[model samples]
Target: MEERVILGTERDFEAFAAAFSRRLHAGDVVALSGPLGSGKTAFVRAVVRCLHGADQSYSPTFTFWHRYEGTPAIDHIDLFRIDDPRESAELGLEEALDGSSIVLVEWWRNAPELVAERRYEIEIEGSGNGPRVVSVRRVT
Candidate 1:
């Protein structure tokens, strides 16, 4: 089953993310997808803050990956620059899925293979001008 919510503002999105954090744990994978300016990074930032009590999350667009320290740690990855699954493997993504930390991936469509059975799939739909419809689903 999927849970859907409409976030009318940034605060609402953050609150949603904060609450969603409780459902996550080590070895889990989260896949986020949305268009530019659709609040994907913001949602992730909130989740990181809620989990670690500090805002250490950032968009891995240019860097490709960012690792955060927490109870179980977090590996944030952005596959926007990757051309294919082969390139994703070249980035050590396979090793990152060793079930030691939580992995949150952006632009997951570019590397669907990285998403495992026990994963959370989040999709945000909007242009940042109004309320965005966010859908959260367990992908197992």
Candidate 2:
């Protein structure tokens, strides 16, 4: 079954992320697609916090990706700069995705081909008024 949520504020986004975290596990793949300032990073931070049991998650926008190891390491990747999935492979994404860790990707459109197979796509849309409409599409 598919689920949906409306994040009316930053705290709401964090709550949503935490709820999503409960459903995730090692080897899970989440593809985040949306425009800039759409709360992708915020969502990732929340998930990382749930994983790390802290509130110290940072964006990997410029650094490409970051890995956190604990109970289950999280591989957070940002493909905003990458042009294609092949290029992402060059960054070792193909090898990293062995279904052994949770892979949360931002700017997923940059490497759409990388996620052509089974994956979860989170589409974030601006409401213009307030609250972000996050639509989660599951492809298996």
Candidate 3:
């Protein structure tokens, strides 16, 4: 398990994502825990951008999942509207937990069981001046 504290600005988040990208292996699962309007999607964008060397678009907040054919391939999932954990299984969410891709799950508390045994959790809290406080934790 590894962890770090990162800044809240877009650029700082991007830099943090880039640095984290270096340590990612194929079966990496990152669980993002934050309230609405947090920078989960923004941070994911930076990661996908770093992996592909090009810009990827927004999160599939409504559709629930977005796939990016980046250098390492990334699957971004937002479970905000999901009301039940079992619905995740019906939605094929388990497919996202593959060993060949990098998966980032936002609002991951919705379906905690979907997360891998070894995963990274990023918690974002409100800081003064409208910035964010990000805390990274990895399961042991």
Return the TM-score for candidate 3, rounded to 2 decimals.
0.86
Predicted candidate 3 versus true structure: per-residue lDDT over 28-96, tens digit per residue? 999988777778887788788788777566446348898776556688888898889988887776556
Rank list by TM-score: 1, 3, 2
Shift in Å, residue 45, candidate 1: 0.7
Expressed as tens digits, the lDDT of each residue in 9-112 for candidate 1 is 88888999999988888899999999988978778788889888874654353488877767788788878888877787778766568889888899988989
| All-Cα superposition RMSD per candidate | 2.3, 2.7, 2.6
Q: What's each prediction's clash count?
A: 0, 0, 0
Error of 3 at 14 (Å): 1.7
- A best-first ranking of the candidates according to their lDDT comes to 1, 2, 3
Look at candidate 1 and tell me the lDDT of residue 1. Answer: 85
Number of the top lDDT candidate: 1
> lDDT scores for all predictions?
0.84, 0.79, 0.78
Q: Which pairs clash in the backbone of model 1?
A: none
Give the Cα error of residue 9 in candidate 1, in Å: 0.7
What's the residue-level lDDT of 121 in candidate 2? Answer: 83
How good is model 1 by TM-score?
0.91
lDDT of 3 at 72: 66
